[model samples]
Every structure is written in structure tokens, then in C-alpha cells.
Target: MSSASKDALPLRHPVRVETITLRPMTFEIAAAQPDFAAIARHIGVASLESLKASYSLSRNGDRVKLEGKITAALHQTCVVTLEAFPVALKVPVKLDFVPEAELATLAAGDTGEGEIDIEVLLNEEDPPEPIVDGVIDLGAITLEFLALALDPYPRKPGVSFDETAPEAAPESPFAALARLKGSE
Candidate 1:
């Protein structure tokens, strides 16, 4: 989803497609000791105190699936109060990677039907990313998912946006006359 996102994240872990097979391989990936300073700058968060990723990679013919979890603790400035608050994220990463040649097929078969069911909507899959030059950047891909999981509007707990509803309109200047005329 973010091909044009920040210039290829710093922690690059390239996995060659030819190396994977039907058997799944598990891997844990992360920057040594969080590197909160670097992550905050890359993703533009108030601060990313911790970040971790672990997943299993498996191949089925041309489709490569990365299933894992990305855990992170960050601080986002609240849009309502402008105060930085802590937020914990556990994003599920199910990135699908396919060769450039086969990706075209996935895009061409999109039906125009709109989804209405909550289950279907929640299960909507992300578009498959291309395995460029026989390599997939799992580190960058996982971080991209982390960035997407950030809340655009982060409000601290107990904060509520209460909008006052209009109570009643003031009486018109000719209110008494209008009432008397109606009685007649």
C-alpha cells in the first residue's frame, strides 16, 4: 500500500523468493534496542519507545504469505488536547507478495460489487505487493503496517467531544400578535 512511503526504511531485511518453500520459516526482526530516536523520525510520531516484530514466512506456488504480529508502544500528540499520550499497538501483518508478472492478474479481476457486511468489510485483504528482483523487504513491509495502524485522531482516555445541541429559538417580536390572530 505504501510503495512511495519513506525511502526504504532503514532496517531492511531482504528475503529471496527462491530461498522459501512450502515449509514455513519463522523469523523475529527488529532494530537492536528499539532505536526509538530513529523510528520517531521515520514515521513522524511523537515518540516510538518500543517496536518488535516476529512472523512466519511460507510460499504456495507464486504466492508468499507473511503472517505475524508487530508490537509497538508509541506516544501520539492528542488532536483534542495537544498532549502526547501513550498508545500500544499490536498489528497483525498478513502481507502477500507475488511476482510482478502475476500481480497484474490480481488487479484486473476486481468486481464492482460494494461490500456491506461487517465481517466481509473487516476481512478485506490488502493488495498484494510485488516481490521485486526476487526479494521481499519484510522489515520495511512490517513497519509500513505499523505506520498504517496509528490512530489519526488520538484522544486521551476520559476525553469526550461534546457538542452542545441547539436548545430552542428565541421568541419573535410579533409573537403575541401572531397568537392573538390565530385565536380569532
Candidate 2:
């Protein structure tokens, strides 16, 4: 378990993915450590912990597809009351990584299609390549998936929508009287 720095609002942790050399791959991150606070901040949550993920990677020529399951505990401030609320998530994520060159070729209107180059796509400029050992970084993926899954507005349990409820009248006696008369 790695502890985060106390000064920053968000914490940061390094996750390592195990390298693999096969297709239809399966990887595990047994009890991977993550900077929960940082992840929470990234996802606009109050806090997070106990994150884990397991996944499989498949390569068909130059296209890499990843499918995985993620589990984590999260805390966030209630949108209605400003109180802290905890949430749990168990979600599956699937993604396709495509090479920039192929994207460019396709964009430029290339017709005759050939096989894509996986190595070239893996070596793209931004966003470092995913670590792919037998061990995967469950923590990082959990954070990412959680961010995608999180609700922008979170309310406490049992909260209900009341669209039909009457809106509060303006804080003037005349306005209140007018509303009351209109309702009648």
C-alpha cells in the first residue's frame, strides 16, 4: 500500500502493467496500490479506496482490444446537502487502441486496405504505452473507469426527483400573494 502526500488535495500513485507477448491475453493486478485521493480528485469525488481490476487484451493485427472488470469504493460530496457519501462500483470496461498512422491513412481517404501495424500504434507519441506484464495496473484502470462512470451530480440514497413540486415564490409578500392567488 502506498500513502499519498499530505499537502496536495489530490494524490498521485504510479501503476505498473505487466508486459505480455501473446494475443487473447489475460492479466491480473492482485491488490494493486493506487493513490485513491488523486483518483477521487480526478473523478471529482471526495475519496476512494480498495480498487482492483482484472482484464484481457486481444490483438488482431494492429488493433488492440481490452476488456476488463473494475471494482472500487468511492466517496463524494452529496450534491444536495454537501455531505459525504460513499459509493461502490463494479464495472466492465472495453477499449480499442488504434494507431495514429492508420487513423491518418483512413482520414486521408485511403481505399485499398492492408493489415494494421500493432507495434506502430503502440508507439504513439502521447499517453505512454500501457504496461502489460502478467501484472496489470488495476488501480489506474479502476480510476479511469470510475471517472467515466461517475455521475456529475450525486445525491444521497433515497433521494427523489420532484419536478411537479411547486417552485418557491420570490421573497416578497406581494409575490407570495400573487402566486397564491394564481394557484387558487
Best by TM-score: 1
Error of 1 at 57 (Å): 0.3
lDDT by residue (tens digit), candidate 1, 55-152: 89999988899899999888988887888899999998888889987886555554556432222245677668888878888778767888899887
Model 1 ranges with Cα > 4 A deviation: 1-8, 109-127, 163-184
Q: Rate the local accuracy (lDDT) of all candidates.
A: 0.80, 0.61
Instruction: Report the C-alpha lDDT of model 2 over 1-184, residue by residue, as the tens digit.
Output: 2223222323223323223334577766544345565556667888776666677877655555678897778787787778888899888887655555555565445344655434435655433233332233444555567678887898889775556867876599887899899998
TM-score of 2: 0.58
Kindly give the stretch of ten consecutive residues in candidate 1 with the minimal lDDT sum.
112-121
Error of 2 at 4 (Å): 20
Q: Which ten residues in a row have the lowest lDDT in candidate 2?
A: 9-18
TM-score of each: 0.73, 0.58
